[model samples]
Target: MKTITVKRLTEAFQLEVLAGADRMDRVISRPRTHRPGLEFVGYFDFFPMERVQVLGRKEINYLLTLTVEERLLHIGNVVKYHPPCFIVTSGQQEIPYLTLFCDQEGIPLLRTSETTTEFIAKLDGYLLKALAPELSIHGVCVNVSGIGILLRGKSGIGKSETAHTLIRRGHRFVADDIVVLKKLGPSTLLGTHNVTAREFLALRSVGLINVVRQYGRRAFQDETRIVLDIELSPWQENALNNELEVIPQFTEYLGVQIPHIEIQLQPGRDVAGLIEAAANNWYLKQHGYSAVDEFMKRVEDGMQQ
Candidate 1:
């Protein structure tokens, strides 16, 4: 959600403008910013607004081909260009007029030792993130085989304990304590975790313990396609009405609709077994079978007979 600006770019790197130094401080229109009425000068100008500019050997070669008038035109076009911010690539190339202009105009004149290709590839990522706004949040997730599962409940509802049990039973933990949920596209949900917190699962018996230390790194998973959810709560048979023949449905978390299953918990119950059953039932549904509906059909047929 943070917008990258030209002023921010100037401060990030050592820059030395080759031309149009006077216009260095001018605002370049960023396609990411989506500002109106701005033009960009060169195809190679995909630098981050926050990057330091450096010169490469090839750019000097390009500049030598122009007449003074043509050179001025290119500089003028560059100065007048909008959006994509500029960085001359490579190290210590002389363009005195441009450098002086940059100093005077307050445009960033960055100089680096990296080749243009490498610099562009590296810095372009920052600009892309600035241009394209994506939302990321932290939470815990798991991949029950291919079925992505997310567990959420009150602070002490055994969320981490349940996740740990699943991991020991050969299910992969996507995230343990804190899970990050991101929207991939319309109607799609993806969840992952920070590396530092990925394998760390908390338990009521102790605080946070490292899963990798206890179970090894293989117990953790990078990410998963979240297809189902499990919300742990103290079991209440009376809470669920008879008309509710199916798992209660929920389609939104952090504002996204996902298939959800409310797993009401109680003492002395096999929590891991419940999770396994849920995954298996979901798998059956994925393959076009529904146990509840099938049972309902059998009951109706029996009544008719």
Candidate 2:
């Protein structure tokens, strides 16, 4: 499980720390936050200790109705679980029960300017992206005709060269050598350039090249959802033969399967054009059409006639 620190979250959201400044190094393992509305009402049986608790206007307003000792008892019962932190939203002025116990219990008590709903939504998005399962693979990721494709094979298999050609033909480049694949949802794998080598393409012929400097901004994308994987291998006369593949293939990454294809490379072959065709074909398949299946149907009908 990926974990983020309380200090980083505070810095990212510019949270005003009312207590537990020394415990800012505490780690948050969960990606979601809890409101603790029930816990505030004397229901601590099922309190979540590890989550970041949020005190919105509703919770704070309810706290106003109780006496100071009752407030302390209620908040204290909830704080004994030792939550990662508490975030008070909606621009609230004070919650002494929270501040006093949070400091004593070594919990980070913070405040945000955004409303409860808005802050929760933003925090969810940030946490989803930051805590997503990540993997780095050796390949070239490019956006050909708006279809994100991954070119994979052994080293020096011309992945970069093919991506260079595709970019020259107006396609957008995503990542060159190492592609970072982040699984945000259950079945979605997003591809992007390596952090250290962002937007830089390495070609064997001319060394390292900056994509934006060479091909302008339109020819590059910050990230793309990988929809297809293409494996390129050197063609051998004995091992290679023309084959009609009607059934679609797939490649798995982080448990998500994506459409896949294998193309053999040889001298005088238009690999970039082939990749473009594959992207168009995949787009057609997405729209309930398959040229290969249609061709086989036509052949069967002719044979029967």
Candidate 3:
């Protein structure tokens, strides 16, 4: 299981330490955070002690209503299970007894300046990205216009070169060679290149070149959800552009399927232009239009005449 440390959270969010500052390296084994609303009222049954507990405005106000000893008793029962940490959001007035109890229990008590809602949203998003299941695929992903197209082919099949051409033509580079895919959602796979090699793309003889340095920031994208899979095949005379039927194709990765297209590679084939057209075609299809279907309808109507 992938576990993130409490120290990482503090560093990422710049959380101020209230207690147990020495226990920053404690692992947050669970991805989901919790609001111990029930635990505050002495309802300890089924308390999720493994998650990062949050004390928002309501909980802090409720605790403030209690007598000093009562507050300690309730906080004592809550932290007795030894949760990973407690985050005091909304920057409310400090509850010294709660911090004192957490300090004694060696549980990290941290506070963020952001409101409870905003902070939780950001925290969950970060945790999800950090801990999502990962899969590395062999391909080059690019953003054509706004479409994320994954170019797949065997080694030395011009995947890198083709992506380079697209970059020159104003498209964005996503990943090259090995694309790391994170299953961020049930049907969404986010793909990105290795950070160490993020700025570079390779082509035979020419060697590795930094696209960002060459083309500026607009030519590079950190990650994209692959919306199209384009496979490049060696040119076959008479076999290329032979599809008469207008059926759509799809490819799958980590249980998510996206539209698919194939383009044959040959001298003067205009492969880059074809890919751009494919992306535009995909946009058209999404908006209830298909060039092939429309062409077929026109042909059928003409034949009847």
Using lDDT, give the best candidate's number.
2
As for candidate 3, its clashing pairs are: none
User: Can you rank all candidates by TM-score, best first?
Assistant: 3, 2, 1
**Each candidate's clash count:** 38, 0, 0
Candidate 3 lDDT by residue in tens digits, 177-244: 88988777877878888787897899889999999999999999998877888999888878755666
TM-score of each: 0.59, 0.88, 0.89
Query: Model 1 Cα displacement at 119 (Å)?
Result: 12
lDDT per residue as tens, model 1, 125-195: 44543443234443458888778888888787887888888888988887866776655545667777766
Candidate 1, TM-score vs. the true structure? 0.59
Q: In model 2, where do residues sit more than 4 Å from their true spots?
A: 44-46, 238-244, 296-305
Cα deviation at 267, candidate 1, in Å, is: 3.0
lDDT of 2 by residue, 26-63 (tens): 99887788899898887777777787888899999988
> Which of 1 and 3 is ahead in lDDT?
3
